[model samples]
Target: MLSTTVYKQLPVVSTTTCYQFVRLSSTLAAPQNTPLSHIPKPSKEDHHQDATFVEPKKSPFDVSTRIYTQQGIDGNDDARYLTKPTYPHPVFPTEECESVTVTHREPRTFGDKLSYNGIHIVRKLFDFVTGYADPSPANPKQYVGTRYEMTEGKWMTRCIFLESVAGVPGSVAGFIRHLHSLRMLKRDRAWIETLHDEAYNERMHLLTFIKIGKPSWFTRSIIYMGQGVFTNVFFFLYLLNPRYCHRFVGYLEEEAVRTYTHLLEELKEPGKLPNFQKMKIPTVAAQYWPELHEESSFRDLILRIRADEAKHREVNHTFANLKQKSDRNPFALKVEGLEEPQPNHGLKVMTPTGWERKDMQL
Candidate 1:
């Protein structure tokens, strides 16, 4: 059934086409000799795409965050071993974490007032942008609706953004004090070490959360802008009056404690967040915090982090109250045979607001 129209349309046939034509001609001429079963069948494909692409079930940015997966432990030859904790994380007593109350130190001074109010504004703006509202009893907008609901993704977004900025104050303060120590050729009264440690701890918090949640590019861009602006501005402000900066950080940590506390409360509710039910501790996290194991719950991780914020809140408020130049960091070392209880690294003795200079031995 060779058509003149078919030859005219192609103009010239390829070697493959000529070979196919010859085979067809021979097969027709010798149909009986070559059994009909030997001939090839022209098949029609089902749901085949010649020139089209399929969409992904999930968006690229909405996928799970990257986590560490070791091929197999080769006698402790792990890359994470190279990096050590600058300051060891204090172990939290389960009872102590349960006893953790959302506490705040009322702003007494002009600087404290400003720091307190500023944190509120920043938190309000951030909450609005990230589609997060505190579901705590204290929040005015607490309701039962999809819009009011806080998903795992939303919580992660809030934590990632909060932790990203939280580390900045400590780093800036530590860096400045370090240079000041070198320039003055005098001791920083152990302030630099504590400040650096606080910053490092906050960074560890960020790292742990990132393993659980992946932020979109839009969220990442916000982090970049926020970090840059905050670091530069905080640096300049600290130069003028370091006290205000500490106070601001103290207030900021207070908010962090409040936020995490709310998260813990939500986690207690049954059937709200199913993802967290099966969530395991990330390897990086378990390695950093010795107490954490494969079986540790996500809530356990948050408790430790909340305790950390409480510690930072205590430390920063104490720093704000003390003489930045002369006062010794009380948390760095312990004094023996003190008549009254003093501030320590762990939650053994705590001042919710902060320790006043009058009470401190130094």
Candidate 2:
């Protein structure tokens, strides 16, 4: 049994050694049978030409390629571009852009004259009120509110008054054009006349109240400043352009005088101002008028009312003639005290009388 076992073990030992020898034989044959180029190749040192890697080509539409920086061109400066378009994206280039000259033409129409004169008067009136005093001695013209209030109210009244009266004469040039669109008075010369009549009515109503001593000091102040400025501007305009200004001032005075006369007739009868006895003087102004202590009478106020209107009427009438004279001369109508008042162009007050025809010596 031992002998048979030993013979079988010999075949097993030989089979294990043969398996190991086959593995060794294959390892030795593997490298020897490979091609030369297939063997491991050595890594060479880097060359400068090899180190450079080509960068990708850039596109024409890149942000840096399309963007540009620009500066502004000033009016006084010479043309930045010699032949650039006059307008941006213009169809054609501009020639003589630097040498081009602009010539101003004089105003030709009546409307233009009216606008210029009206604006000039408005601006001058504004300037006059700049340092003017309110009627009240306590409140000097230091406050801008006083000037603005005076300017606004006077501007409205005078604009209406001038447009209404001046428009009557075709001399005003643009008066017809401006009045053409007003629907209330049929957009005719009548509307301006109505404005004049209304202004006169307002003056009458106010004078009546002042005579009755019913309006407050504050209300009186507003009305007084407004009227005073209106008068000043009216006179100033008359002084500026007499032929046209006379129509407005003369009309205003006539309307105001007529209204005043009518009011006087109405008050002479007993029925007007029913509460004359009951109404009291404003506490402030009554400090000046002692009669308010015993209660006010409407009859007593009438004379004072008429007197004020007459005073303005006289002044306006005198100024109207002055304007007429100035128109003839086309220079300042120098009044005695107001002489040397600087003329704004020819619009200034030069003469003592007013506008006189140039042919007729002032």
Candidate 3:
């Protein structure tokens, strides 16, 4: 049994690992056999009556309210402590984030065309269902207040849904490769770790946005269903052709870059997205992106996120070009004193399409 002092020191909402939660649950569980109203009822007097009360949000989607990790937990349990990130996010300089552009790689090979068209189809279907239509760079008038335009809620909905799905590919890919390595009793050439990192980074993006904007229950349900379907589909396809899967994800990242870049352009119009303009970046966001601070606005946060998408685009596209099972992950390890430019985790040197196999030392 834990002492009173130890119980008092426990956090209200822990960002700890799963086994800790399991252990805590076991400690608190009712004894196995004695039942039939054996436990005593609570006294009229309430312990910790002075705890802060948080009103639950009634609206489906509202940016006016922000969700902190322990908002409601403070009333039920008062101890809340911050947790360090499992995977530290890469530092993105302001200039490097700004350098991110919406670029595309032409689909030349048969596999490339198949991946591009398949992704394009899925995107259009999703966009229509979510009521999101990008404001064309050419059509200036369609930026706001139209049937074709996106509102704060719609944009948040898209972001949450997009990220929920985006995280799946990397995890699925990494799992298959990891199993493959174990079965063959050979090294995976350092691909599994990079893929898992991509998944974690995408999840951070989702969590950061959740603090800034609430999604509707319908949207949440959609995310749940979407993730289930996409996970299984990606899992099976990866087993069949990992290269094609990587190529498909590469094209998907191209769309992600385009999506964020469009959002950045909308931020330029004064008074257009007032909520975004006045909003301070969430603590989770600033915590993940160390370069951000109290003064960072939503636009600044988007810039960092866009830069991440740019990197993923580069990484996945490059993965598609390499010999899947044999080639080492070039981005994971770099050669020193090499005269030629190389692929990197950061934006220092990047290619919109991918690094061709011939360009790499392999």
lDDT of 2: 0.34
Q: Give the alpha carbon lDDT tens digit for every residue of 259-305 in model 2.
A: 33433444454544233323333222222222332244433333333
Q: Give the runs in model 3 whose Cα sits over 4 Å from its true position.
A: 1-79
**RMSD (Cα, Å) of candidate 3?**
14.4
- TM accuracy, model 2: 0.26
The global C-alpha lDDT for each of the candidates, from Candidate 1 onward, is 0.79, 0.34, 0.79
Lowest summed lDDT across 10 adjacent residues in model 3 is found at 46-55
All candidates' TM-scores?
Answer: 0.80, 0.26, 0.78
Model 1 CA RMSD to the hidden true structure, in angstroms = 9.3
Per-residue error for 317 in candidate 2, Å, reads 1.8
**lDDT of predicted model 3:** 0.79
Error of 1 at 354 (Å): 0.3
